[model samples]
Target: MMSFKRSRVIGAVSVAVVGVALSLLGSACKSDRAVFSAPEETFIAAEVDAGECAAQCSLDGRSVIRSCDGEVIETCAAHLACGGGACQAPCAAAAADRSSNGCEFFFQIPRYDPAKFDQSCAATFVVNTSLEPVEIALAYEGRKLDLSGALFRTNPGDATLIPHTGPIAPGESAILFLSDRDPEVAPPSPYDLYRGRIACPSGVVPALVGELPGGTRIASAMHLTTNVPVGLSMIYPFGGARSFLPSATLLLPVATWAKQNMIINGWEANATGPASQIYASEDDTEITILPKVDIQGSIGVKAARKNMPVTYRLDRGQLLQLVQREELSGSIVESTKPITTFGGHGCAFVPSSDLGPCDTLHQQIPSFDQWGSEYVGVGYRPRFGNEHEPMAYRIVAARDGTQLDYDPEIPPGAPTTLSRGEVAHFVRGTGDPIVIRTQDAEHPIYVGAYMSSCTEGFNKVSFEGAGDPEFVNVIPSGQYLNSYSFYSDPTYKDSSLVIVRAKTRGEFKDVWLECAGQNLTDFRPIGTRGEYEFTRVDLAKSGQAGQKFGDRVCRNGLQRLKSDGPFTATVWGWDYAASYAYPGGMALRKLVNTPLDPIR
Candidate 1:
């Protein structure tokens, strides 16, 4: 069995003490916060490369896609300068062969109706994971939604860099607000909107290359690229007078584009809104959709029933969004060539509708080749000082006659056998973590974790509300990584993380976590026995009792976590009747070949 190896730095060693970003120290000198310390070498040191390099479109055969003018250009493979508008070159590589760093990416920001959810802050974060500095920009063609004057802000600096724009130092991030907000409109001072954008000054710059649409909000298909590889993440937080429901997901680069995928999402029993599956094409592509439920087509599309396959064609930079009242889980999507796919609910009342409120769900779907046979489901620990609530989950089978076994005992309502394209729904109620495994590596499944709904009686709540419905993919144990650079949205007052790692002989392999200069130590074991264990820690809290809805803050921006052995973490934030959840990160290694045993 594959297991996490301990870091070579040191074993269970405690080191320097950093100042806490929030909360007062206890009288006994004990931190109310969980202590998760590790070897001194676990914390990543940021390095900056002062050298300069000329920019070239290094996505291989991918064209520049578009420039100021709408003229087509030749392919940019060998000696071609990086200025022409062309489509991506053909990529026959498998999805598992790709990594976090890549030159090109396609982003179709999920459609959020202002009528249903707040659209105050929508942004896509681009992080330079590589050691060297890289130039990043946005690209699109035949736009449906205009992005004339969208703005981006990097690290603050003197007048050396472009106005309001500076070099994204290694391990730093650039925030691109996804709105046509006027440049002269003077964004909020200190930028206290979503995710806390800092570095005030002339460095903010318009990042798109098109005509400015006067104050028009954006929800369209666009492409982004860097001179070198970087990481991309999307966060849509409804941060206004209404609710604070946020949807977030880490995007896979174009190098990981795959032709086959399955939609695993929450089941909404009512007609509140439609569950959505969106496809963004980087080239002229043909796509076939086999939805598990009936789709109420719109505009130029026709309605289709369950098990019926619908076909559509999309040009480079074009997008096709399919929506239905019923849940789209178990849907099978395949294309002639590689394309980017996303699945989630526009807004859903998870488990049941009596939970009072709903939240939007969004996640970039990985290709079938990236699916795994094993996973650890650790439910989020109780916040608001209430009893732990069950976390909802779904396991979508990729092959027929798939068998499942749990480490301890299977949760109630779990199915041991599932046919192809079948989805089994269950919930984890206990605080202990559960390890789920398949019969063999040949049978793989996609696992999705969901936060239980917020109600008056079921969960303790203040005016800001308790945990509501949020959805994020569960990272497979085989895809665990040693380090990750992730961002926690500072808007939510109650923010926490669920950390899971592999262990052996009733001992932990030792991993460390640091956010806002404070290192976390002391992770307690959960469950009776297994090769894995988990612990939940609070990154930011509300009032004294940790129940306040609007009193949370953290160190300005992105957080980095490193360890000697591999582990997985999930971030959760909630307040004011809204909440959001997403995995810290995962390695998309090709584990299975879908073409050989195609998903039916």
Candidate 2:
């Protein structure tokens, strides 16, 4: 043997390992796509400082400053309390009075992008009260946003406070920052978003200075654009990128307005008789319909005239034909006669039924069942000249066994009674010999053949193959059986068999024979008799025909066998003759206990 290349073997092994690893990696990556984690927070408040506490705060590692006043703060409380130095008692009292002549102050805060940064975006504000500590609450419209550490200030320079922190006291301010970040939060659908609203805590509107805060409060809504990554496929929206706009214009009732004037008028078209019609102009691509027809009979009447057009676009000829066909076919089918089951077959007693009289008979007799039995309940039109001709009739016996006794006492006009064995005799008598093997017996018997000359002759013949076989001038029977007394005629050339067995073996012996005219000799074996199982027999060859042997042994259309070894028995044909003899050829059977690998 030649040695394999070392490099080739190494390459093949590496490829297989890599393939397996890639498959596992792909599956793991698919699972990770749906997973989301809460955003992390890194910024924390350091200080709060003095009077008119800073309304907004920004912090670096070492220090924090009031965003509003640019004042530095040492502690979170002082920074939150007042961005201006600690408020004078007189000034605080004056601010608390609300009617005092002091300047009004306002501040602004920026929102941070959570998708990119871990730092909290926050703001602080201050309020002064001369009396006891006042409970000032903080609220904003963007409360649904994932601002986890965000806080609010009651007074300037207050350290950022987590949500639900106690209400702020007089002269004290609170800072707002991102706090509890919920990763599962999903953007609301457009329909729900349009109807959504947010309210601020009592007495907590955006600050007003000298001028009044007059317009409707502005609510900040975000519109996101998600782009498919390069080299990745985008499915829905059919494009690589999708964009959304959170404009106030989308909130208008455009759909409702359009429906009222444009769509509704076009739909309510003219009605002539039972059908209503609508037309659409090229400029208006659509038309809506609101027919006032009665609902009960409307479908039928509409269906009748559905294709008729008030406009000239409809094809009159096609529409008329379709309407006529539909009405005619529906009416005819509804009035047609029904079929009734009789003698286990569907029989149509009336002429209105599409099928002829013999439909039931043909349906009841399956092809396989008709193979062994004559007068098999199958319907066939007899040829004119063949009407009076005698036909061979084959009958099956009950499993308990049938008696084939000759009844000599019947009137000459009465039909004869042939038993199971006599039927076999008649089948063999005709040129077309058939073999029948019963499971109750060990050997197969030859059934009689079709007699063109004598239809009654088959019935007269005894099951034991003895009798004054009367010959009727009929078809094949008189030509073959009359010449050969043994009823083994091979003239017509088509010989078939029907095997009826309780059970078949896995292995059967293949018996071979040598045929010479009416003489048969030298029975030999073909194939491994004990090695392969045989289940069926093929009489297409002269050697296999029992009539060639002058003994009609296997003509009952069946064969029973007894075997000692664990082998299947089947007889099959090889060429066209086999095809003709058994339309459905032999079946190969294997023992259930045999290893499935070999059979498969």
Candidate 3:
């Protein structure tokens, strides 16, 4: 089995304690933040060479994204030259790879060491983004890789670097090429999950691009930093199982992560299918899983099961094997220290049937403090072949006597009040988004959205099912964002963006989307419920060589989205078999993005 080797560092800086702009990290306690701590022999990267650096600089508080209009700011560290919105080092931009100090302390937590996992994959990169002139630093396998003297390219052709590279200039990015290796053991093992920290400024949207295991598919996602004290939701790509493309994205920041939680397995929805798994944030955290117990209530319902609880401990940076079950599959997970959790099946059919709409399932569940009382769960489109798996939203209440109200309302028999350990699932009649709110803020709940398979039919009649079922913990209204930069599955040719925002007066009109530097105008309101409204828009996928579609904005990687009001957006992906177009295939994700605003 590929497992993380434990190493703890006693040092000046901890990878967990990323020290840049520290005040913005929300908490003063180092362990409570998202990053791993650095070793004592660390690189004070800020101390860059003064040789030919941009003259003049400033430290405009860490609260906002500064636009560089070719002017030096008010003040800058003596070693840095500030201009063009970022403080840069003359030495940093002068070279691509250079090592200032040997950061040999190996205690950085949540690490990615191929040797420990018994893999020989050589991970490399060519980085490029809309944000240029960005310096890059990486701590890998107990050493800090230096790119201080490496090369940076604007239009990528052969952007390559290792361990580190000089700051990527604007209009420039680098490329990474990692060789896929075989597992050391022949016996089957759980999937290998990688964890580490990559840092740049919040204005810089980074991405780790490469191939996954033996699959030819591209494993990539936007690498946005999750340290914003106010907009923490920006970091929760819920990383693992980038199912839409079958790779890893980003995961929980230590701030919004929980030390304990529960998972109601697939058995909760379908006896024949719907499985689940648990992913830990850090290694060595002990997790206890209690079996599903039936609610003991008589009238209304409770939220959880109180049955057999099993305890297991995991090494740092490991994912528990996914277990598929046919009976009640709910399990409560309690951990000794803070950690992150993902609950979903390896692959299952919503309204399970072998016929259609099937894909792998994965979602990072939020800790209790991150739960919200108000939410709008908007389901995805129907499966291929006209399959009628209705969009289902399951609400798990955390308190007893919690009253739930729905906009566009629930069916006559569905109960609105739920006790602790109870779950209330309701189907949406309109494809538009539906709103649910608790009577008071005292009770927060978990809202998960499930899409039906392309195969299953509801009323004894069925349509052609195309893809598979998947689930994701919806972001809370409190974590809603107004601006972001995101990337779609580069492997999937077809894509759609589902946009959700609170319907105040004329706010939707201000939503803007830009691809390949062209303004998009195809957004249309699909539906609305109570205080929220939904909009759907198709994305232009890159077409054939030199065969251009007039004004087609179909480019992948590093796209931008911004709105005047707080909003939620998800990007869906499917196949390109021209025979099975857009809605024909299946893949969905709540887009993780970097914010354009300062901390709230």
Candidate 4:
């Protein structure tokens, strides 16, 4: 393991606070709303000597040698002269052995001298090559001996090591300097030496040597060296201490069990054990072991079991292990058959009606109140027309259910349209029965109708209507009023009409029109079309109407209508009948109490 340490510089005074403040101020200033103006543009040209250009110019710098069309030609120029061209440096010598089929070779060690032992002492090994740039790495593990060091390489004739920033180019050689200790301490031990090199276009094999306990030289221990082919797989063993159950039984396949124990690099203990159980094969290929745990006490002890089957591959006599553990917690045993065959089924509701005939009213009018009294619950069925093609038609309200005047001239097979007056009448329980139309022939054609109980004058009236009364009331008051006043009564004051905005088309589909009448105490919807009608008497004039009796009455009517638009006419004039007018057929025939005295 390598640890990196950094030195911190101490200051005579604490400047961090001021530094932070300055930093914040700088950021604020940069982000402030300020503008900067650039200086005027200027251009100039100059000449330099050819030798000066080659010496001072770098690949990244602007080396101007000529000018064309008012643009400077600053290329990687070797010379500044007008006709001078680029030049190349001489190449280095290649390796001596070029006939070898493989580019692999072993490292040559120099004789060691005890007199030369020093902390900074290092040995340099050079390898000459003609191959293109390649990568190289060195690794070693010294357990019996404590030799720890690093390696560095330098360019030829350079006193200092060349930072290994990039690869070495062709025809160039690399020097690997190895030191047992850092430049400041002397080595403390003499141990086995191992070194190797790998060049492009070929592979290299390393040589290994070890020393006995008594310091007896083990001459050229080449057999101990491991030569890994390019792209070869390697598995290093590792071991650690852990607590386990004493009676636990590990069931694993032969191959995976092999990785349980082995000496890793002849240094660290690679087997996880205290040695009660072990697994081994006749050949060195498979090896495994299950170390037993020594329990302090047998109180309430239970046996635990696990089984696992794993697979792995072996490359170049190296054992690669992969282990998967599957455990059984309780005594219960159950087996399941493997899933092999499968089938699927699906279903859909086959409605008997065509798209245009289905009871789409359910989607449009969710409640019975949405449709007036003319329609009951709606039913749909598909039918084939003359061409044998599917077509749907809506079942209109029963003949007895609709009123005599309940004939709506809606376009056949298309959505029905009603005038504001008609809509008001329907909502007021005095209009014609509801009708359904579908001219498009593609959309659903169902219409719903339900009876609405409303009080008309002194009697309770039953209105025969159709479809959703709620839908009839969903129109945005603003757009509805705007369109109504603009078309029906241009003189109508904008303020007299209260407008409402709708968020969706469904809400806008119905409009609620309300206007106070002399017979009503609250505003009420006009008809099924969301239209409200205010007679001239129902409207109130402005305050200036006080100048004249007619104006005063008109203003009073306007105020009453505007304030109580949703009430009945009779209720509206119940308190101020003297100021209003009524015909013999009017809902409010007469007023007992009058607010306005007989004109003088």
TM-score of each: 0.72, 0.13, 0.55, 0.16
- Model 1, 1-600: lDDT tens per residue? 112211111112111111111121111012232232323322211121233111212122123311112122344443222211122221211121254445677765455333333223456766555444557667656533333334343221111222234556555565665533344454434333442222222333334322221111212466776665566777764331133456788887777777887766545544245445445554567777787788676665667788888877776666666555666777778887887667676667666644566667788778788888988887665654543566677888888889998867877788889988887778775265677889876788988887766763222332236767777888887677555556555455666777887662235556544442333455655445656767666655662122111232233135456554567878777766677777766767667754524325
- For candidate 4, what is the TM-score? 0.16
lDDT digits (tens) for residues 1-600 of candidate 2: 111111101100000000000001000010121111111111122123333233221211112333333444433332222112222232231222111111221111111111211111112212222122333322222233322333233210111222534533322223322121122343233342232112122222222111111111111221111110000000000000010100000000000111111000000011101111111111222212121121112211233122221111211111100111111100100001111000011111111111111111000011111111111111011112222322343332321233232211222232233232122222222212222223322111112112221111223321221111111101110011000000111211223222221111332222221111111223222222222111222332332432323322332121222111111121211111111111111111110121111100
**Candidate 2 similarity to native, TM-score:** 0.13
Between candidates 1 and 4, the TM-score winner: 1
Clashes of each: 18, 105, 82, 60
lDDT tens string, model 3, 1-600? 112111111111111111122111111111222221111221111212233122211221111111212132243343442222234442331111111101110111111112212222222122221122444444332234433332222111111222334444322223322222223334123444421112222222223222222111111121222111111111112111232212121234333445546564432433223334444445577766554553222122122345645556655434443333432332456777665554544334555544443344445455554567777666544433232336566777766788887666664445589876576666554264566778765676777766544445333344332333445556556545444333343333434456666543434434544442222344444324345566655442322111122443333333334443446666554432111111110111111221111111
**Highest-scoring model, TM-score:** 1
Clashes of 1: 18
Q: If ranked by lDDT, best first, what sequence of candidates would result?
A: 1, 3, 2, 4
lDDT of each: 0.55, 0.18, 0.37, 0.17
List the candidates ranked by TM-score, beginning with the highest. 1, 3, 4, 2
Q: All predictions: root-mean-square deviation over Cα? A: 12.5, 43.4, 15.7, 43.9
Alpha-carbon shift of residue 283 in model 3 (angstroms): 6.1
The top-ranked prediction according to lDDT is: 1
Question: On a 0 to 100 scale, what is the lDDT of residue 490 in model 3?
Answer: 35
| For model 4, the run of ten residues with the poorest summed lDDT | 237-246
